[model samples]
Target: MAITSANQLELLQTAEAVAREKMIDPGLVIEAMEESLARAAKSRYGAEMDIRVSIDRKTGRATFSRVRTVVEDEELENYQSELTVAQAKQYLDNPSIGDTIVDEVPPVELGRIAAQSAKQVILQKVREAERERQYEEFKDRAGTIINGQVKREEYGNIIVDIGRGEAVLRRNEKIGRESYRPNDRIRVYIKDVRREPRGPQIFLSRTAPEFMAELFKMEVPEIYDGIIEIKAVARDPGSRAKIAVISYDSSIDPVGACVGMRGSRVQAVVNELQGEKIDIIPWNEDQPTFLVNALQPAEVSKVVLDEEAERIEVVVPDDQLSLAIGRRGQNVRLASQLTGLDIDIMTEAQESERRQKEFAERTTLFMEALDLDEFFAQLLVSEGFSNLEEVAYVELDELLVIDGVDEDTANELQARARDFIEAVNKQALDKARELGVEDSLVEFDGLTPQMILALAEDGVKTLEDFATCADWELAGGWTTVDGQRVKDDGVLEKFDMGLEEAQNLVMTARVQLGWVDPSELEADVEDEAPETSEEEEA
Candidate 1:
């Protein structure tokens, strides 16, 4: 393109103006203009030549040139970019094989079409700069609150004007009862900033629990100052919410501080939420205590914790069941989220009935397995004998705890229980041998002979077969039966192996079979070994 004095003088000014308007580097705009001018020059010069353009960074003067590289005759891959040693002598005397030579080219007139191409190049650069700016501005703003105007609505989703750019509040992320007209002000959580094929998309949410946390941080000085920490938050947007807070200072009460003077602080947040109720709970370190606090306003009669399963069984009075469970189980569900444990709520009556049923089942099991009479089995069950293993392994004094039970009778019952287990083991071994299971598998750490038989029965007859099974599969897992999930015991459980033990044994088998290198196995073992040691210490 021709660089007239008038156009040349205006180019730098145009770049500055566009840079200010697009909030981008002025140098980038100038560079885009250079590229546009170079492409236009390609129409004047042969497109095969290595045509190039450069605009003075300080001055607006633009120059066009062609570049060629001197190469050995055999190395001349491209006629445009490379010149042979003999041919290079035309441009430069005593030319070597690797030197580059730049030659000046006369400028051509900048036609209407060429000008249009330059305009497009400028616009493209501006757009890319704007997208990068938007991404950088919002990326770190995730989990923080943002205020915006309701710009427009498409289907059920709302587009919000966040000052410089528009963000989307998806239909699912909006509170069910909330609606916004265009130009209405709204507060939302910056859930994410994603780069899409079109551009950077900012995703906003009104229902995220972090939004509630940020709101409290705005309203409560203690929370904002980090004097009181919001441990966890659970929300049923447009309905009820629970937040657990704790304070390190003994003088400060975290719950009261969050509630504010006469409930003003919490009420402000509640008003912003359109009257959604908020429960401020004092967080406790103990799981049972935290659970009790989370399941507030409902009296929990009993709490049974299973650390291995990460579950809590909460028994409440029959009258408090509905309150503890909330509408369609929302209360217990939120409590579960707050504590990071699965919660099962039951009424006192239901729990009592379950205990009685369990007692009856245990009595029946003992009666059938040990050939014992109802009275003796019931006595054993009463003495807390829940299974054959427990009965076989318990001290003699534990059996004596049952009324009218003597040492001889206890010994005889344990002997029968052991005999039954031995018979079962012999049957499994015989069947396993018939199924062609190797003896090597039976001797592996954490694998019992019975587990080997179970593995063989399930077609895991080799070390490789056992090694490839997932941890859940090895330690037993649930399968859906008629849409209901049911537990089927795995071989590891048959051998009384914990989940970690099962994983370790299978990993060892993998390393032994050369499926995994010994060094990689050691690395994994080192990473996992510390946690295992801590658990064992605990």
Candidate 2:
């Protein structure tokens, strides 16, 4: 094919048609055509020549040119593409060493092989443009729902034709036992859109928790209008799910709005999810109260929460144990996910047994440590005195409230408790020193002798070592691994050290060692402090 007057406009017509089909910009196709023509021109006009081609966007006229650059005599390497300033005097009044001289050249006629190569180049460029267009179109659409048709099945995965591009619904992303044939309409959540070597990979999902929340937003007018918000969602997918919702307006009920007048809205969502049952609970700011709501259909006797550990214990009647835990522990698992806490469900009988065991253990410790009889130890335990430290430091009035205990008896109890604690502390300090613990760490405030011994045993023997430790390292914390929370033990965790206390103690040690400026610490604290409004301040 030859670039002549006969088909000059045909080039642009072809570009427009291809761009329309690919849903890409027509300018990109025209740019691809120019490069293909230039490549073919170079093959005929000598490969070493600087051949360039430009197509007029309006008239679609192709112009070919050969460019040569003026270089210094010593730097000129290619004679066909380079010219010296002295050699360029004939064509110009003055030419600099970096100036270019362009000469109009006749366009090359495309032979059979050259035309085929040019077509391939245009096709490759068009494909790249199409991929880029797809990526740009769907990048921001992630975390949204889209309706598409099943194109085909690759192994167990579903390839969906999502308007401008194809998306992949992985086998694991589908609801349990979900099967689809070609041309089946499906609604999916746009889980992710990633740019790869082949193209933009749009991954779709039918089992995401966000999918249910979005469905409610689509069905409930209140949710769409921002009167209600979906706080959390946990789904078992194709089985059962739970959603916590909150309403901004006191007159509007979030749960009722989602449920509809007679369960129309929730039923619609249930049909889409293949009959998965859903429990819509009202959201509460208090975690324990929220957890009680999350574990529905079961009566809870009491709730115990450990804020630092992100764990909770729920006591239910023995008959409701199976209901609270659900079949295969699904109810508790979903509740845990919704509340972001690890839940331990026990019957009321079990809780009482555990309490009795703890009481017995505390009573025995007091009896052995303070040289008291069983009855006296039990009485102290019954009075809510759990440990020697509380007994040693408690005021006389507190002990005086106990039956058969006067001021003299209270004084005697404190002396015995203090003496026992001092002996234990001295033993621990001596053990820590035997383990090569430095005096700098031993004299550090806020750490007990037992804490020092624990740190010494863990190879943290110096103040520098303690200062270098992370807050989580001093106070045990939970880590999420493989979608499950795992506990990380801390050396000082046994002393009930919280992360804030650990951070403060570490900062104090750093200040004492001159590793950190106290002024900077104070500035950081001030920066973190919340500002009060003028009205509140007044």
Candidate 3:
């Protein structure tokens, strides 16, 4: 085959036809054709030569050129494609080191082998362009819902024809045991779009929590109009789900809007989800209040929140215990997800027993630590005294308020508590010293004797070692591993150290060691401080 005038327009027609069929840019196909021709020309003109080809967009005229660049004397590596600046003087009046000299060359006559190789190059380039077009089309469409036809089922995964491209709905992303054959109409959430080596991959999901939220948005006018917001969603996929919604408009009830007249809106979403039950709860700023709403139809007697740990304790009546926990602990689990907290559900009796047990433990601590009688310790515990430190440092007037206690008795109680605490501290300090704790660490202002002992026990003896520690290492934190929260016990966590306090202590140590500048810390603090308007300042 030869690039003759008769076949010049045929090349462009073929590019246009392929571009239209693949739904890609015609220019990309034309560029691919030019590259294929150039590769064929290189084979004919000699592989060492730089052969270039271009096709006219309108006339479809094929032009071939031989390009050689003038280079420095020592940098001229290619004899056929590069020329020294002095040697280029023969071709031009004055040639610079980086100038390229182009000379028109006859088009390549493609043999059977050359034509086949050219076809392969064009096909690969067109395939890459098609993949790029698909990736660009769906990249921004992720996190949306799309309607498509099921193309085929491969290894339990449903491949769907989503208009110009195909998407895979993995078996795990399907709702329950939902199955579809070819040509089945399906609605799925566009979970992700990724560009891989093989091609662009579009992952579709029917069980994502966002899929339910999107369905509600489509069904409810308020949600679509932004008057109502979906705060949170937790799904068991086809079995049950919990959605938290809030209304910006006081006149509109978010839950009622989603439910529609006679449960029409929610029912539409439920039907699409393979009859998945959805509990719509009102959103609340208070997490405990919101959690109570999430665990619906179950009466909550009390709600306790540990803000630092992001954990909650829900106490219900003994009869409502099973209801609050639900079948296989589904209710509580959904509530935990909705509130972003770890929830512990217990009966009222269990809560009461736990409280009594805690009270007994505190009474025992006071009895042994202060060397007081059971009656005196119980009285102290009743007065909200939990530790020897509290008993030692409390206002004298507070101790005087206890029944059967006078000023002299209060003085004696404080003396005994202070002595015991000082003795315990001295013992801890001695133990830390035995563990080779340095004076630099012991003298640090933020840490107590027990904190120092704890750090020393963890092999952090020097001030530099303490400074190198992460804040989480001193203030126990939770880590999500394999989608489950795992507790990381910190060295000084038992001393009630918080992340912020640990951070400040470590920064202070760094500043004292000259590892960080005080001025830079001040600048950072200023940068973090919120700007205030003049009216607010006033």
Q: What TM-scores do the predictions have?
A: 0.89, 0.92, 0.96
Candidates ranked by lDDT: 2, 3, 1
Candidates' C-alpha lDDT: 0.85, 0.93, 0.92
Instruction: Put the candidates in TM-score order, highest first.
Output: 3, 2, 1
lDDT of 2 by residue, 288-351 (tens): 8999999998889999999987889999999999999999999999999999999999998998
Q: For residues 328-378, write the lDDT of model 3, one tens digit per residue.
A: 888888888888999988998998899899899999998898788999899
Residue 64 accuracy (lDDT) in model 3:
98
lDDT of 1 by residue, 1-538 (tens): 4687778879999889988887788888888888888878886676778878888877788888899999889988889878898998887889997899998888778799988887797788778777878888888888899899998889889999998788999998988767889999998899998786573389999888999999999999988888999999999888989999999888999999889899999999999887889989989889998999999989998899977656689999999999999888888878987998878899989999999999999999999999999988998888777899888888888887777879998899899999988888788878888998876676667665678887898888877788888787877655669633466676666655567777778778888878889898678769886454766778
Candidate 1 vs candidate 3: the lDDT winner is: 3
Give the clashing pairs for model 1. none
* Candidate 2 segments whose C-alpha is farther than 4 A from its true place: 44-49, 68-98, 111-113, 510-538
Residue 488 displacement (Å), model 3: 1.7
